[model samples]
Target: MPFQHPETTGHGYVIERYVTRKDSDHPRYLELNGAHVLRPGWPHAKRFARHLIDDATTITDAELEALLAYEWRSRLTAAWLIGVDRRESFRERIGDLLLASEVCYSGGGFCFALARFGTHADAEILTAYLDHYLPRTDLHYDQPDALGALLHLDARLGTHHADRITEPDGLWDEWVKGVGRLGHPSHTPAELRRWTDLHCDFINDWSRS
Candidate 1:
């Protein structure tokens, strides 16, 4: 089902399509009489995304989306939208592309994004990414974000380690394991403790009222 946001007009439709977004606008966007137009500034990525959102009914539209896979933005857009369609092919392709990206870098916000449509294999892919790069990361947010993704996916799988959530080191041990869990190699114990607290603060209300 589409996510309901009663606060906004068009509700879930607004999140489904990227039309009203000013954040992703190309810097070179054209304006005429206060109207937004232009082929380049308004990218095909958004249009293809619309097709996915509006439920494309034609083979040609699907064909075009397949061709548009050349862009990472499209892949990211599709990765998020695939949950609505639940197309296994879309999941496989998006998951594969996302996995490739994750291998090169740590899972930050992208991990949470991937976790939204996360399947079992996607969880494994993310787990591999976090298990490898998270320990090696110096980025302050990498550990929490990576762990958040795993936790999010695990929540669905009934395997979440939220039991250990109150314990700072317990959270870290799952990802880094052994010596690095306490933040010696990449961070300090104080820092890990702060992250653990923040994680609880978020998870406490993540799916709660």
Candidate 2:
């Protein structure tokens, strides 16, 4: 049965109310919510996934693999939920997700969510991804959304070398602005000032062009 949000009132009220029920013994309670519903297609999957995670039910390895195949948005939500589990299964799946691509919202969210774990292996994996995939100035790097993902991961992973990543007179400035929205440490006052200065210079040069 699909889990419903707690605040929902109607035919689904039973499902909705059960979501927040504090009783862990309930047979229907799941450990991980089905985030697939709240995603673009279902719009209720997120609540389901949350309910499942909160319930503490065991998530099988096969189920985890199926989740990884979802689209970026759903995958990101799944990753965040999986990180909450703190299981070896979750860690392995998340590692796979990181290598797949540079998903903006999900990748960024996953990085931030997993940051609290602070495991050495996880850190090494994220750092390696940045080292291999982030240094180039291609469409992936130039994309503001993608840049936001990179910056979020960088902040959580404490990645340095902002100088190497920024393009002198291109969309790098805009990317920084997008990163600012993530509320990561990279958007600190000093960092913001640095980005602002670079952005101003880039805009000035653009006007002259």
Per-residue alpha-carbon lDDT of candidate 2 for residues 33-103, written as tens digits (9 for 90 to 100): 32222224434434443464553235444444444454454454455445545454466556556656645
Tens digits of lDDT, candidate 1, 1-209: 23223223323333223322333343111111112322334444344334434442232334324422433333333333343333445545544444455322222324434465556775676566555544453433345455565666666677644334425655455444543544646544345434433333332332232
Once superposed on the true structure, which residue ranges of model 1 sit more than 4 Å away at CA? Answer: 1-52, 55-68, 102-118, 139-146, 161-167, 170-209
What overall lDDT, based on C-alpha atoms, would model 2 receive against the true structure? 0.43
Model 1: worst 10 consecutive residues (lDDT sum): 26-35
Off by over 4 Å in 2: 1-58, 102-104, 139-209
Residue 185, model 2, lDDT: 25
Q: CA shift at 51, candidate 2, in angstroms?
A: 3.2
- Our model 2 lands, by Cα RMSD against the true structure, at 15.0
RMSD values, in order shown: 13.1, 15.0
User: What is the C-alpha local distance difference test score of each model?
Assistant: 0.41, 0.43
